[model samples]
Target chain A: MQAQTQRYSVLMVDDDPEDGVLVQKAIASSGPKVDFQFVASGAEVLDYLFTEGRFTDRSSAPRPNLILLDLNMPGVDGFSVLKQIKSDMDLRRIPVVVLTTSEAETDIVKSYDFGANTFITKPSSFSDMIEVMTSLKSYWFDAARLPTA
Target chain B: MLAIYEYLFGAASFVPHGYCLAWRPDLIAIHALSDGVIALSYFSIPIALILLLNKREDLAFKRTFGLFALFIFSCGVTHLTAMIMLWEPYYGAQGMVKAVTAMISVVTAISLWPLLPKVLALPGPGQLRKMNTQLAAEIAEKNAAQVNLHQAYQQVEAQVVERTRELQALNQRLQDDVRRRSLLEEELREKAAQLIATNAELERFAYIASHDLQEPLRKIQAFGDLLKSEYETVLPDEAVEYVRIMQNAAYRMNKQTKDILTLSRLSWDSIQFDSLDLAEVVEEVAFDLKERIEEAGGKLEVGPLPGIPGDRTQIRLLMQNLLVNAFKYREPDSIPEVHVEATLHDTGAPGTGGACVEISVRDNGIGFAQEDAERIFSIFQRLHGRSEFDGTGIGLAICKKIVENHNGAIEAVSSLGKGAVFNIRLPTSQPERREIHAGTDTAV
Candidate 1:
């Protein structure tokens, strides 16, 4: 079969601006071309996903093909956001990958229990970060098939 | 004897031969009255003696007193006869009565002669009074002694009552002390449980802090790497060197945070123990370190290892850390050789005490000083500089923590240039589930 050349979009939620910039740069450095959007906190992730408030223009803010969720934030943390996404009929089909600095077993287990697709610890070096992004892109975009968006 | 009795009877004639003296009424009355009074007095004395003797069965010398009473009675009869003759002639009867009285007197005198010495030896009334006074004095002394004894008895009884009361008071105090101690112990137990929960919470916080702290450090290192690689051609050499230094520091900080997280994660509550074959753990560790072992030209000889109760992942990590240490710290000219051996060791004697699995990992490495053997297990304690060996200095500390979580003991023995041997003793049976309670007062 011919390789499906479908473009994908990712919504990343993180409170730290530096971490968000680093992840974007690392993904851009690595090959797979993906459209990325950044939201500061978990509450903004829900608004962006449902096209509410500032994200009311659904055409301009496209639905994310995948969600990169951070666990710790000021309000409405990643766990609750994940719960809201997985429980909603419109957003349950979207794959949610938890990317956080916490390597705690409880965090990993809780993310999975809340219907996260994958849990990955953010790598500490540029090389390691690139390697992780490469693997994530290959597995989600190429190997696994997604529902119609 | 019959003829004498007849003569005595015929002698009772009324008159004698002539003695027509003056018969004066006054003289007659006086004489008869005096004789009658004397006779009555003597008769009363004998009757009283008879009554006394009859009444007092324990009275001494009964026959002698009877003889005295009879003699007195005979004398009274003689007086009576004399009085009767003064009134009537009766001279023959009077003469006969006199004769009888004389005979009785003679017999009484003879009997009295024998009893006279005995009567004379008896105590007089005056002497008896003196003896009675002495006896009364002795009785008074005895009564006084008896009173003193009764007083002493009362004092002793009082002392006993006092002692009993004191003992009861002491017993009550002891009971109160025991109750107070138990209450304090219960409160202490509750405090200990609370302390353990707080300690667990603190550890969790440490883990979270270390984990979260690594994120920014990671970003710094990544950006520094990107800056270096992307601008290597355009940037000056000094800027590249600065980036290199920044990246190195970031890398070290990252490693330290990771080690801290590992240390905090080594908690007993999170460990699950099972019967594990340590040889399998060693094999896996060796496989994982195959490249390093081959590069170092190391020989790992693993002997028959016994099964012990322990957390599988922690035990694997412990073996890996030790093996890596053995491979890393080798003599300059010597080939690395590590011998891992396990044996069943009885704490006391066979079948007497608990059985333990004694595991020894001996390495042919450049050994540390003897004093540093204990210090090596402390976190971030390094004997050599970072140039000599590259490590976070947390491997042995993690190993120690893992062994402690298994309720086991671990120690290292080493001398300069003689290599090091690590001995681990683990119970074959499951260790008791230990709850992390607060420390005791003494421990605190």
Candidate 2:
């Protein structure tokens, strides 16, 4: 398994289009630009990661460097999605970062328990979102090594 | 003592009722001896009287006196009668005087016959009991009077104590009333003072929500406009995604406005009241959340619900919010489980009305930190992450308001990751509406 402390393509699995867009802006402001993709639901993420059906071009779709998950989405929320990602041995080493709009303790603890690499709160302001994104870039890209592409 | 035996012995004289003894010196010596013996009779009555006087007090003094009087009178009469018999002379008058004196002494001794046996009957212990029996009724009457007086005094004392307690309680009530009135006056002043501050706060909140939050939201919306209208065809996928990000923040801002507005409205002093069946209200909520429950692969086990007096709309809102929260915070490994139970109780519990009912909702989900147990019922008190769970944080707060409106109580108990239980107690029977005779209902 590749070490989690490496740069790879990131995925955002969320239902809210608005939240997905906000997270994208936050990531853009962050340094050491990395490739990223978005999926609408846990099912789509799983299918894309597994190269199933619509996601058959496995070579083109890179293994996720990290996953930013939302727990309260349509079908098979973030927790179930985390369970599947962590359970699959081939994909288990990939880092997971939980990006949420709440600071509830239960979510933080559960995110860690399910093997998330980091838990970040969704900023209420656009500027704070930028800060969260810049920090993510510094920690994951500048301070840590990236897996060979 | 010698007096009676003298007669029985036939008192001898010097002359022997003739001149034989008087004429002979030897015979006269023998008569002198007999005369000397008869003279000892006078000492007997005094000795008998002394014996009678020994136990004198216990004997009714009057009876003793009367018996003594009888003794003396009979003694005198017998003495005089013997004196007359003795005076009937024989041959010589001087000699007859001597003989008569002898007969008088003998009769005086015999006078003790009737009185002797009676005098010997001194007071014994049995006589005391006999005396007590005779006087017992009188003694009892006097004692009964004293006891009755004592009992009446005790009753009076007890009444005084009871009155003292009542006066103390009344004084305490008055003191409490004064304290409460002062508190109310203070609260009225405080509320009056807060009216201006509250208005100012409300205005500030509206400004923050409208302007500060709207800046980024508007920028996001404009950037989206700029991208879609100007560069939609030429821009790369990544560049278009950037514009979409800005637009998403704006849209969320618009939604937050509505949520905040509803929260502000919740602060309004709107009294909720309506007489409705609580059971039917819960059923409606269960029906509304049926889809969520099924999707979670959990069943909402509703136990028998008791019909109670409450606001139907507010109660329905409370059940809906909590059940939603349960489903949202489901444990990863375990399916969500919720048990809703309601029952009425009368035992006049502390938080309960003399006749009140309780509704309990227990859930098996990801429980929160113990510290959050109380705060979870506050506005915007979310225990789980927004990315992990979705909530406005005001759901439990609304439930609290609904319960309080019914003059009821609500509380939550939870352990970390173990589960949580919410208990709600509401007055079932209005104090004034209670029947003169209440019907007991124990529905478990």
Candidate 3:
């Protein structure tokens, strides 16, 4: 079953390098074998999604199966990015999960309003991070079916 | 006798001379007409004077004018008799009338002499006209002055009316301003109430978040323990030490977060206040702290305590925190001795009539500096290192928060190397009677 399954790709958007590294480490430890990409800014996420500038080549910048979005960023913010992605016909079908440190109900509601597939609070400890990543991998890669590109 | 008779007869014969005097008709007619005209003029004058006097009863000197008229009439009557004699030649009658006229003439002359000065003093018509003109001028002047005075009075009345109108307008503006100010004040009060509610909501959110945050930390500690125990042989010594250190750090973090949660939850609105005896609360705390106290070789002396209005659970927590602190901060080589006592106090809060209970927990412990007395009640504040005293440093802060939840106050006074006393003051009854009544009435 594992050999027959197609490997999934995930684009992670976060400004904190340490958090990105921690996620990478946690996923490596407990998650499925999947491709991972990291972007530091919401602008970079948008550039990569639109295949603009340096990401003009479709083969080098393949569209990911899922997007892990962070809310607070220096510029272009998560809500704007989410709005852009959901409004566009080509990108609206791709699943976007909001992973943020905010436990505010407003943030959760707003994420759903922008067509976020999932909303999750970032775990504080490394072991909890690992557990959350394992659950996320299991649910997204193994249980749910993804749309073909 | 014959000679006397002859003489008398000769006297009768003497009138024969009158007969010899010529009987001229012209002379007789002229004399009669003259006398009649004189008499008529004199009598008419007196009648006119009388009539003038009667019409003008208020005329000055009326009696004098009457006497003057009567004298002139009497002179006219004498003339009337003389005219009668012209027709009848009755000498004796004529003579008698003449005598009466003479007497009237004499009286008139005498009276006229006395009244002459007064009659002359009477003003003439020309002089009276002059006086009338002067009086008329004086009256005209007075009328003009009165007109001017009336005009001035009217002007003053108009000014008063205008001033009253201005005052009324000003009063209206003042009322409007007052109304607007009151409205603004009411709106401000509403905004302040909203701000308070928002702050409370934020506090609740913080409490819940912190509580949820503890779960991941617990998991970390639990898994770290699992790794340490289960992989003891597989893990290297340094790796094992790192895991243990991570577990210790996670445990400390968990403790701090829990304290934060407690601090946040202290503001929860569901606390119930009831009348509680401090003696009972102290006894319970003593029993809870019995093992610790025995290990520290401490003795707790509880005196009589008064009943106070408070939340029972919070007050119990307050007593436990203070009692534990008393046992925890004991001086080395000195047996820990703590005294719990309560007395009636005057809180001086408005409307409560200063009825309160002051509970003091005193201990022979390693007291802090006087300046740090206030600092000790801040969360996580520590005077000594963790190795010196085992505490998260949130105990006193929790105590303070709990006491505050009951609308009470707590204070500590201590000097370095001396003992410390923690005093808690709580009202014996709710301070605001109206609020209590409202709460109870609405609660039902």
Predicted candidate 1 versus true structure: per-residue lDDT over A47-101, tens digit per residue: 9988898999997688988889988888899899999999999899999999887
Interface RMSD of each: 10.5, 15.3, 12.5
> Model 2, range B350-424, lDDT digits (tens) per residue?
355467677888898878777888898887777777678766777788788767766688888888887788888
DockQ, every prediction: 0.33, 0.01, 0.03
Give lDDT: candidate 3, residue B201. 64
Ordered by TM-score, highest first, the candidates read 1, 3, 2
DockQ of model 1 vs. true complex: 0.33
Which prediction has more favorable DockQ, 2 or 3?
3
What count of clashes does model 3 give?
0
lDDT, candidate 3, B205-246, per-residue tens: 664556446646655665675566558899889999998888
lDDT of 2: 0.67
Model 2: runs farther than 4 Å from truth? A1-149, B1-235, B239-257, B347-353, B429-444
**Candidate 3 clash pair list:** none
Better of 1 and 2 by DockQ: 1
lDDT of 1 by residue, B1-444 (tens): 766555544434544222232556666677778899998998899999999999999877788778778878888887887777675555555667778778777777788788878888888898899989998999999999999999999999999999999999999999999999999999999998777878667666666557656766787788998887789899999999999989888888888877776776675246667878888889999999999888877899999987777888889999999999988897666899999998887782223357778889999899889999899999999999887888999999999998887767889999988889999877777644444332211100
- Model 3 bad stretches (over 4 Å): A1-149, B1-42, B53-75, B86-190, B193-197, B225-245, B267-273, B345-356, B401-409, B425-444
